[model samples]
Target: MAPSKGRGGRRRPARPHAHYARHGPQPGLSRLHRAPPPDDAERLHHVGPPVPHPTAHRDPADLCRGQLGAEWHPDFHPREDELVMRQHWSSSGFANTDLDFMLKQHHIRKILLIGMRANTCVDTTARFGQELGYHVTLIRDAIASFSWEEMTATFELNAPLYAHAILTTDEFVDIVNDGAGKGSP
Candidate 1:
């Protein structure tokens, strides 16, 4: 868990993404507010519900590149394009989306994860990797969150217990490029 930017008081509902960015970076979590780094070639996958109402104000092209550079919920009001593979986890990390199958098909023993809601999909997926016995690297800078307190709290306690959370996007990419291996925490 990293320190939060703490932008003033309570965050406005429309600016949930901003709220998360203000809270520094969560290693392995994908941030929606920032533009995708050009060099990312790890078959980058954005795991979240789908486009939300606020994203409708943005363009659809952004959705293809990770939903307005963010992740949206399936039932999010005023639906836009939904990420077909985003999965909903139940303890063991397997979702109807078949993310595990996709990884296996790709021969992806190492995963560079990024997406919305640090404590939800991001954390769940990391946990899922542990369950499936795969090496999961959480690129903190690449990830973001909407819940300030919960995000910080979870990383503070849970991350150390469950996953290897790298602090920057560069570190994340370098680790994968270096053939980083994942094992039991």
Candidate 2:
């Protein structure tokens, strides 16, 4: 007897079009092929005002690039027009980054967090956001994790204790569209 077809019965054929080839660079080509080396101004723009380090005299960009090397540096590059901020200490966004300052500057009293590793970075950031007096909302369905158990733990235990609200992506979007404005926080 033959096995019945199920959801994973067959694989679909690969698309004929090369998406990147049509839109941008060809496959196996370096994205930075035509990019210029980091100049003084570019470095300053990315790294922000120098913090007091043991080697305060050395350029922070040079130091970071030297320590991290070329491959790692490329991974840290922000997309065009994206605001990149550095975080140095705990998993909390506000602990070492300028997130608190930015929030205060923009008068943002609430934050919506969605990201990878629900148990670690997301949870920590949400906790810190609450501690910092912001109304923190975790978009539960939008987060990811390696283990179902970890996801369950975050959503069930830790998130309820730390976060002001736990919402699915659709629920959160609906609320926003229904005129729950920014000032709702």
Candidate 3:
């Protein structure tokens, strides 16, 4: 059966699991199974400066200030009036962050995700959001990755599995505008 149109009259596409199967496992999978090259092994073993445990000895505020400038304590790049949600973990914006509480406060059940490292950060966050019961949408064209493979893995392979909807930036804007009405600021 043909997919039904959404409230905005946009038809969602079929999941592309077959496309993922055509492509092999993501590059990271092979790297994980293989031994490191000799040069990398040497560098790995080399006694450089002792690495500090992430959260063992440092105050959270101090760590934030040290990692980011005092003026910009969080890693996010937000516009003047935009809300910023900071995340420490690679997966899940809600993990170790106030995102869940903030969303609940705002009564926001749906999320539109767009960011860098499509296969890594974006994919991880999308999956986690779906698992947490939020309706997750991905702005496909707005996101990017270091390579085509990575982008494909996230957008084609993982997003259909986790995200409730995938749309282009224009599509998203149109839906928002339609819902908000022409006079909305």
Candidate 4:
């Protein structure tokens, strides 16, 4: 989904590289946001003027290097020039992150989604992106859920409703690398 003029006349990025959102520092562990301490943890950097949902629930996405810090595993550290937006909400990455900004800055309109929270984070992000007129694609093999039924429901039943295209990682790679559809890879 590179540099394509997608639905609503929005343009997708020429490259697939995107800012990491909802990639961990998972809230399931009950950690805190990265800055401003846990008491008033309601701010998003690089997220544009007036952070959405000012009166948000109390849940920060990081706690420094604490045992229960809201931080991604060391293996998932952000690469140079990369941004990792911490989602304040459990389901949608757009809730408290700069995902929208990154997408717009890079002219991304076609969203390719993958990750572990197929039924939750992935599902919510995809649905919301579609609502905002982004062409959403789900990489089936790249996503998972807490349960097999959840995975099936996400990719098989519910995804058809919002996802513009659904493909296995291999199929997508084929399209990008080979010629399933050019301009990728």
Candidate 5:
């Protein structure tokens, strides 16, 4: 685990119970929210930068904040064993999403992240989880980016810095089928 503030307000490396929670929306947050984002006092407090109506999807909540309801969710949702979270308030899922708390409650330490935005939101969430003492894994092909370069940069450079293992979808399936991943997620 990471360190925490000592008497002089200096953090020592690897503090046990005192491990600090380095999370939140970043500075200006609208721009710099990542890796223990700025404190509430230092972070942006505005509702938003003001976006236009949802032209792509019928549910504006999927694209904008302060709009919440079932309509914001996709058609695949409301299915069995599926979880529908509110609009992401920050780049790091653990920052405001209660994911870490939920994981720890279930005694889950390893995480497999698969989603869009390989470099931005996915990387931020992985790094934040790694810093908080979770074993993070990124599936290479399961994630995507706007460009090949972004995907390459994340899995090739940034992911190595934090992720415990970088596997492909096939490899993940093999692990599951081989009984190596039977009891966990």
Candidate 6:
């Protein structure tokens, strides 16, 4: 939580809340608009083995080696040092997972989010990250929404307010390199 503005306009940290508020008491169709992702499901409507689109099958795992537990990229990139590129459904980001411990170990101060489905897991994780005090930047190119409209609308209504919607991978890499972005080791 951010602190109240002082008479001099100095900023301060807000006292931690005893508990975070739920978006709403119950999920409605609008809830689907912000639903969490399903990681264990054996299906991906667009990108996994089930997709009919040829290019869509380009293995996400191959492009995302860090999340797959592979060696870091040879580029010696700085974002590679701090930014975590993870599948929303993977055990990596779950509450009980080692992610929190890993972040602490690495002294991560902020998170720049990049992945699929802006409305589901992406949204949930961003919300969770904010509650935990990690600034999240949702890379627009890196993320693929379930639908054009959903993605467009989400970016329109939420991205500016909740997280930054960066337009390219290059910009994201630059931020991480500059240390403006940080996350788990």
- For each candidate in turn, the TM-score is 0.50, 0.55, 0.55, 0.59, 0.57, 0.45
Pick out the ten consecutive residues of candidate 2 with the lowest summed lDDT: 45-54
Off by over 4 Å in 1: 1-93, 174-185
Candidate 4 local lDDT, 150-174, one digit each (tens) = 7656765678799888765555655
Candidate 5 per-residue lDDT, tens place, 1-185, comes to: 33344446633222111111122211221221111211221222111211322323566556655444223223112334333344344466665565666566556677666555667777988899899998887755555556656765786568879988776545555555565345423
Per-residue lDDT of model 6, residues 138-181, tens digit only: 65544555465656555555565666343344444453445432
lDDT of 5: 0.50
Each prediction's total of clashing residue pairs, residues at least 3 apart in sequence or on different chains, is 12, 0, 0, 6, 1, 2
lDDT per residue as tens, model 1, 1-185: 33344346422122234545564334233332232422222343333432321222354454453654454423222223322453342322455457677667656565555555667666776787867867666555455676555466445555557665444554444444454323311
TM-score, prediction 3:
0.55
Strongest candidate by TM-score: 4
Model 3: per-residue Cα lDDT over 35-70, one tens digit each:
221222222211111111123235545435345322
Error of 1 at 111 (Å): 1.6
Q: How far is candidate 4 from the true structure (C-alpha RMSD, Å)?
A: 13.0
* Candidate 3: Cα lDDT at 96: 70
Please state the error at residue 133 of candidate 2 in Å.
0.4
Please, what's the RMSD in Å of model 3?
Answer: 16.5
Clashes of 4: 6
Model 2 TM-score, all chains together: 0.55
